[model samples]
Target: MLGLGAPELILIILAILLLFGYKKLPDASRSLGRSLRIFKGEMKGMKDDDVRSKDPARTTPVRGEIVAPADPAAELEAEARAAELRAAELRAQAERSRTADGPR
Candidate 1:
């Protein structure tokens, strides 16, 4: 991908690993994954909205009107999961800072 050969890709991967270090890599990856998931969901929702707009029976809401999610329980669960991820990230960050401070 991106015109990078195997060796070049390996070198780039190694550079990223060294830059971030092994300890923080997982956290970075987890955040990236969450971001990708959110983006993917948004894209899917946009496509669904496009399809809905094309339908003759469905009326679009007026501007400034609130839109509720199709599944409120699922929305709440996703929010709870996000909060958990944020909390975990904060704890990891605090631990990293504490270790880096070292006997001060």
Candidate 2:
């Protein structure tokens, strides 16, 4: 719709046909149609959902700094530290077992 007319559309289609050949055009068109249908359905659903949700308080904007979610990096570092501690404990237990099993 953005300044595109029938002639421009025809030219564009011909360009695509030249690029992808005739055999693949049907599959490409089918995929494009499905995507457009899905996009249209999603937009309609969002519009309906917006209409059904009309609470004034919900619409009101918060006037403070939004707190960010917990850092994933910190969580990963904590998990790594816990794993290292567990490994150290296992090594210490193994050392004790080896010492006890050795000849006096």
Candidate 3:
């Protein structure tokens, strides 16, 4: 699509085939297709969010306490912190139980 002609396309395809071999091509193609689908979906979601944010009713009230946006990165970071806290609690509980069991 970036101005590459048929010969260039053929050469690129040949390079990919040589690098990954025939057997792995299908799996690689499926993976690429899935990635493209996910990318498209996320792009559409962002576009929709942009549309919604332009409307006054859809946005958070400015005077009230600031509401957190639905950010995936922040959610993942919070989940990771929760998991770490849970792990630490479990380790402490295990240590307490071992000590209570008296040196087995």
lDDT of each: 0.92, 0.87, 0.93
lDDT of 1: 0.92
Clashes of 2: 0
Error of 2 at 95 (Å): 69
| TM-score of each model, in listed order | 0.55, 0.43, 0.52
Candidate 2 lDDT, 12-102, residue by residue in tens:
9899989999999999999999999999999999987786668653453468847454688998999999999999999999999999999
Looking at model 2, the pairs that clash are none
For candidate 2, what is the TM-score?
0.43
Residues 1-104, model 3: lDDT tens digits? 49999999999999999999999999999999999999999999999899989997687667966777668899999999999999999999999999999986
Q: Which predicted model would earn the best TM-score?
A: 1
Q: Report the number of clashing residue pairs per model.
A: 0, 0, 0
Per-model root-mean-square deviation over C-alphas: 9.1, 15.9, 10.4
Candidate 3 deviant stretches above 4 angstroms: 1-3, 61-104
In terms of lDDT, the poorest run of 10 residues in model 2 is 52-61
TM-score of model number 3 = 0.52
